[model samples]
Target chain A: MKDRSGSVLRLAQPVRLWVQRFTFLLLLATAAGLMLLGKADTVIVERIRVEMTDAVAPVLDALSRPIGVANDLIEHGRNVYGLALENRTLREENARLMQWQAVARQLEAENAVLRNLTGFVPETAATEVSARVIGASGGAYVRSVLVAAGARHGVRKGQAAVAGAGLAGRVTEVGDRSARVLLITDLNSRIPVVVESSRDQAILAGDNSDRPRLDYLRANARVSPGDRVVTSGIGGIFPPGIPVGVVVGTDGGLRVQPPIDWDRLEFLRLVDFGLGGPLRGQGGAGDPGGRP
Target chain B: MTPAGGTIAHRVDAAAREATPAVLTLVLILLDVVPLRLPEFAVITPSFALMSVYYWTMYRAELMPAPVVLALGVFQDIVGGGPLGVGAFVLLATHGAVLTQRRVLMRRPFAVGWVGFVGVALAAFTLTWVIMAVLHLALFNPLAAGMQYVMTVALYPPVAWLLLAVHRSWVQAR
Candidate 1:
């Protein structure tokens, strides 16, 4: 009886290993299958993205706090060290800016008079939903940031996310308490913009670089380096005239330098410009930011 | 205690033991998402998720089985905003390569095992870059992906140390 039991036990070992290996292969196959299915751009895959972001929002928020504080401290230290030089530079900049302020005021008054004669309906003022940036997925494949604000906080997909400097990204995947913003420099980003000085219109397309290329410009568009680029608002997603980038030329073509630095992003103001953002359904009752 | 009670307790213990590697891997992936203060860390921080999976599979493959590794890969694809299944397919390939040589690696010293990892990582990263280009339907600057692979291989030693320490503390007894 003992000899028979020993033989049985020996046989069971290999059998268990084989079963486990088989199961592993099966699961791997299933995972690959899901990936192929995801390429269909179905609602189900989007739902999965939203649900998973919701589940992990709180955890990411809690973890990002210290990192944000650390960044602030470093910035403060640098500021104090350069206080003297900064004061002189700021004084010069302030004087220059005052002249621009006077010019702007005069232009505003003229614009108002022109609008009154033209019976132009002014665009609605944008409402801001402020939130901390908790996670940023940066790589060659993706350039996206996750903010603490979400569907629960009146944020919806396609709403523009802006920093103090300029336009940062647009909300792509929104959960209950978190939303993912695809930065302008991501591999898949495409935005319609016009040059501030020349008024030359073009499409800004990201190629996973710090500077995104300006594509489809008219031949001899007369665009120059250092010209400002702002949203054209042709898609009705972003508000018109929001600053996007500055023009820079390379050997290949013109590229735009994004106003906001990727490393310096801590907080974002998700703007509801009332342009009828995409994915406006479900949750956050009575939020009019997304309704058409 | 009744016999049934003892069996239940044993079952719980077994489940927890099986889950240790999964929890570790998940934590590593979470760390990858946070924007820490280190320069060039965001894009080029060595692939923490990949290293953790490789290490656990080397020492304790049973605990960090294929299904759990598969889930980690899909989670990466979702969070990182890449084409789905790319990570899953690549990771499984690495794990399979490791499994074929696990016995030899276990018998050899750490240096030999590191060399083995170098081989598998090269193949995995090449496959990943090719898949990414195909998915995006355009050729991207290869420098970024190449730098990422180099950083991942170089940081393996220190990260493996941390993982080893955690494993000894939280899981050695279990």
Candidate 2:
């Protein structure tokens, strides 16, 4: 009996080792194959990505709520300490803004008259959908965020995501219940922008850096630090004249300092300008005509 | 000792104990993807999952096996929106390499284990950077990757200590 048991144990040990080795090799090979497949078959990989994201979006949305509350609590505490000082500043700013408000109203009335005289066809109005940010890029070389709203909520690819006073990013992928917003700071992001002060066209190209550089400006373009950059609407992906960023540095190596306070971003307003962007088949495919 | 329901309870407890390592690793992967909302935190979210993977792969290889690692890595890749299978490849390579060096790591002092972890993190980050550059066919700025590696390595002691405590109380006691 002892000899028989010993022989069985010896056989099982080698078999177990072989099984372990085989499993390891198989998993390694599978992982390598997936990398190649991701490159070769992007459509399927993207589908899987969005489906997985949709599955987890609810959990992420639930998880991020507490963090948002905590952030607000901290912000409130900071504001409380400066309440008196802030109130005075706000009061002064409000007075100043009231003057500007009258000017803006007068300009709008005059512009309407001018448009009527020219028989001009007005551009489509934009609608905004609010979404809460649930996931930021996970320390990879990517700059993106996942928001809780998706195609079901009228969020679509190439819609401009505005947050924290200016443009943040554009929707790159949309699922049934979640969407991924690729930030303007990602390496692959390129935006057609014009320097507002000089009206010189250039492309804002990101290199995985916070300050995306302005490239391909006309040779004689006058670009200086503090020049405002706005969407040029060349591709129709974004509407013209949206506030993008402020230029930094000279014409040689210009960069833009986006107004977004990245750390404090908890919500986004995705604006669809009824243009359907250039990627869509028709101009009005994404038309949600009236303002939200 | 008791019959029927007591025996079922005991079995359930046993199963939970067996699942502790993998469950903890999964939780860490989730933590890695969750936005912390800290200033500049996105660029250096420190590979919390990698730390857990390294710990379990080094000490409890059977519990954190290759298949489990692959599944967890894939989940991380999907959630993080990174290139598919990159996480799996990095983790599987780490698991394979650590298995060969287990004997040495097992007998060493904590400091030596940390040094070993630093070496592993270096290799892992470098491999990831190379794969990303190749996949994009463009040279990525290594500064963020380098920063993440520094933070990951710096953060190992506390994470390992937590895992060690869990292993001692739950896994080893059983």
Candidate 3:
């Protein structure tokens, strides 16, 4: 009986190894197949991605609060040392800003009169929803952030995510309680922008770099360093004249230096301009006009 | 204690033992996706989940099987917001490759295992870069990939030590 059992066990051992190997191969192939499926059927893939992100959004949200606080504390500690110098600089800037405020008010009054004379119809009222960034794409390939607000908070796809003093990115995916913002630095991101000074139209294209490059500029667009780039609003995805970045390099390749301090991007103000065009109401994966 | 109660406790303990590795791996994955908020930290975030997989697969292959690795990879991909299934493919390949080397790796010293992990991580990152490039139809800047590889290799010791401590205390206690 012992000999027979031993032989049986010996036979089962090889079979078990075969089963394990087969299972491993099957799973590996399944993973590869999923990648193809994700590319072929992006709508289904996006739905799954958003659901998965939404499920963990709360856990990530709770986990990130302490880290945010810790970072703030560190910044505060460093700021204490530079407080006096910062105060002087801020005071000077405040004085300058006060002068600018006066100019802005005058411009507003003059613009209103000009608009009334031209019978210009104003755009719809814009709305803002402030959201905390809960997660980020830690991998180098994707530059995106998961904000704590979602469709439930009136955060829709194609809304502009502004951080600090410039446009950060646009909303690509929105779940029940979480949304994903594709930053301007992502390789997949493209924005129609105009040179604020020259009014030359160009496409701001990202190559997974901190500084996105300008593409498709006219040969004699007269673009130079220190020129500002703003949304053209031609596509109607974003409102016109939103600050994007400034041209920092015009040699070899044009690079725009966005004002956003990405490291300190803890919060975002998602702005909705009530403009819907070619890129609206579709999964941003198949965006034809570089809407998001 | 009642005999039935003792049996229930035994089953619960066995279940917990089986779950420990997966739970630890999931936690590391969540850590991988958490926003570090440091300058350029996102681009070079180490593969913390890979360390967990390597540690468990090296020591306890039964608990850290290919299916579990695939599931964990999918979760990481969905949460990390990268191209879907890329993470799953890379991790599944890592598990298969490491399984064949398990015998040799097990017999070697900790430092040897660390060296093995360097090769595994390099191969994994290269695979990811290639797959991403293909999907995007453009070559990604290899600078970020190189930085991530270095960061993952530099971070292995502490993560491996932590996994080892967990293995010794909770996994092997019974």
Highest TM-score model number: 3
The residue-by-residue lDDT of candidate 3 on A68-109, one tens digit each, is 999889889999999999999999999999999999999999
Q: What root-mean-square deviation over C-alphas does model 3 reach?
A: 3.9
Taken over the whole model, the C-alpha lDDT of each candidate is 0.80, 0.85, 0.88
Ranking by lDDT: 3, 2, 1
- Provide interface RMSD per model, one decimal: 2.0, 1.2, 0.9
How far is A91's C-alpha from truth in model 3 (Å)? 1.7
Best by DockQ: 3
Estimate, for each residue in B1-174, the C-alpha lDDT of model 2 and write its tens digit.
Answer: 112455777878876777888999887887777787888888889998889889998888878888999988888888887778999899889888889898998888989989999999999999999988998787887888999999999999999999999999987774
Q: What's the residue-level lDDT of A181 in candidate 1?
A: 88
Candidate 3 lDDT (Cα, 0 to 1): 0.88
Please give, for residues A1-292, the per-residue lDDT of candidate 1 as tens digits: 0223346648886666677678867877886687667666566777887788778878888888888888889889999999999999999999999999999999999999999999999887888899898887755677888888988799987888898878888887788898888888887788889998888889988887878999999998999889999998765667779999899999989999888777767889999987755645322123354545
lDDT of 1: 0.80
* lDDT per residue as tens, model 3, B9-125: 797887798889999999899888788788889789898988888888988988998999999999998899888799999998988889989999988899999999999999999
TM-score of 2: 0.88
**Between which residue pairs do clashes occur in model 2?**
none
